[model samples]
Target: MATTTGEARAGTAQPASLQLPGIVLGVGLGGFVDGILLHQLLQWHHMLTSTNQDHIGVKYYNPKTVSGLEMNTVWDGIFHTVCWIAVLLGLAILYSRVTHSRRRVWTSRVLWGWVLVGWGLFNLVEGVLDHHILGIHHVYAGEGQVWWDIGFLVLGALLVAGGYLLQRSGRPFDPSAPTRREARRA
Candidate 1:
């Protein structure tokens, strides 16, 4: 008998722990995108991009100064390292969840939605703490950069909303249902 969505949920429903892997993956991947696009490709900003003006401890991020730029580059490297670790950890968790756990939530919509939520969360928290509160860096890192920072937050919010909606829409998904590939394997 083909399993209905209802039966799948009841028979092999994903527990709370199942969501962890997807969320972690999302956060890590999101960080990579930000670091690569903003830090490298766009060259719009860097870790501590505008910290010099804050007069904080050892301001070392003046783009005009070679030393300052070097300092910023070092910090950016550190940030990227952390992001890389997150991605690795997430992958480990996901692998364990899929291989060991009997109940797998493979619903594409649900997984992607949670991932989006995770990414949005990363953006919001990172933006608020690093950009606004800590005064470490801004998105544009120049005069009147608040607007750019705000825009980043706005984008994060939108991702969060979209992800949330997608997740809700997939509430009835049945991950236990065998796909054609699984049938072929069997």
Candidate 2:
């Protein structure tokens, strides 16, 4: 089939997997944000805070006590480990999708946009399952905690929509071609 220069360029770009890699990466990184910001820094809630009713056989631990804090920390470590694994997996998938050098794809809006979507998705899934369904932990906890949970979901939805728009507008990356800097030297 005859192809225009743009079509040819786009065709050679070896279409980026816009969603999977970024979302997976975003989910992992987002988990870090939750773990670091909410769980550790702020000392708001832990993995098993509201699990008394959620899991009948689960042991309840109060965050204020040293013993309870130790258990929560352990659970947080487990959560972080899962997030780290996710990041590694995401990177592997992203590496497989790129046809040429990663220069273009790494810097492209599409990747970052999908990342935002992924982060948001993480919030939605975690918020729904842990916060709402299982009653594990709340974003703020205490008065008006539901609002905070709802806000988390809202932010996730916004990220997905915004990321979709940004990803759509991104130019098809052709990393096999020389970057502008390399082109200038040529």
Candidate 3:
């Protein structure tokens, strides 16, 4: 007897707690992508790309000059460290919460959806704070910079919406229950 989607939710763990770990993980991982892809790989911008005009009294660290490159590199390292900490914290939270077959949780759409939510949240927050409010850095930091920044926020919004829908369509994870494959086998 194959269990229906509704049956999967019967023994699910607390949804609130279940959603957290993935979100934290998503935030950290998303930061890594942004940092590695935009800042390092492409060399499009740096930590303090336009900070000189941010109205925060932050001096611009031009990525071209030796001293500027050093300062920017230091700030980038700090950003990466923060992302790493978030990932560690996420893992710790997941470990403490899941007592049974963590395999189920690992395969859960709900958790992954929450991760998407977290990533989207990161983009929205970062885009607003860094690109819009503080003017620390834009996505491209050149002509059509506003478009690039807006596009980032748009993508974030899409991720949040898409993830929410995907999770809603999924069955809840029941750790102790037989997996779908197992149920089908029997």
Candidate 4:
């Protein structure tokens, strides 16, 4: 028997376990972690912390003032809402893909690894945009804030590198491959 080109490609394709759900979860959960730890718990900054009186020209929120705090709180709520949606969307994608597939989809390392990549992507993008581009806020808003901001970028890079390595280590799922038990019986 000969395999068609489509079949050949399918046999070598990366597993779905490494894609949708993990990336979605990574972005959403990553956002939550940042928001919860930095914004709420540590009081490091808020969604619009640096927007007020800055070059952003919004002046919508200021962490130093009561009105600013209220505005920032609302923006934070909006950010959380977006993150929730990302999570829900990811779950939906994962469910749809898994349910429609004939192959077994376990919680593989590829999934976890891609998730870390997604998270790192989130961190890198968000950190660069909010902290550097828009000047919204820094990881730490006191003296030598640049150092903290740089650290955030470094962490993001590390996560991305680590995740990529982990993902690479995983073997692609071959639909035609025999299971260990099946092979043993042959």
- Residue range 87-178, candidate 1, lDDT tens digits: 79877876665533134455456777878987888899889988888877888877779999999899899888988788756644333445
Model 4, residue 80: what's the lDDT?
93
lDDT of 4: 0.75
In candidate 3, which residue ranges exceed 4 Å CA deviation?
1-14, 174-186
Count of clashes, each model: 0, 0, 0, 0
Descending-lDDT candidate ranking: 2, 3, 4, 1
Worst lDDT run of 10 residues, candidate 1, spans 98-107
The per-prediction CA RMSD against the true structure, in angstroms, equals 4.2, 4.1, 3.9, 5.2
TM-score of 2: 0.83
Candidate 1 vs candidate 3, lDDT winner: 3
**If scored against the real structure, what TM-score would every candidate get?**
0.79, 0.83, 0.85, 0.80
lDDT tens digits, residues 71-97, model 2? 988999999999999999999988877
Stretches off by above 4 angstroms in model 4 are 1-11, 100-106, 173-186
Error of 1 at 130 (Å): 0.8
Assess each prediction's global lDDT (C-alpha) against the native. 0.75, 0.81, 0.80, 0.75
Please list all clashing residue pairs in model 4, or write none if there are none. Answer: none
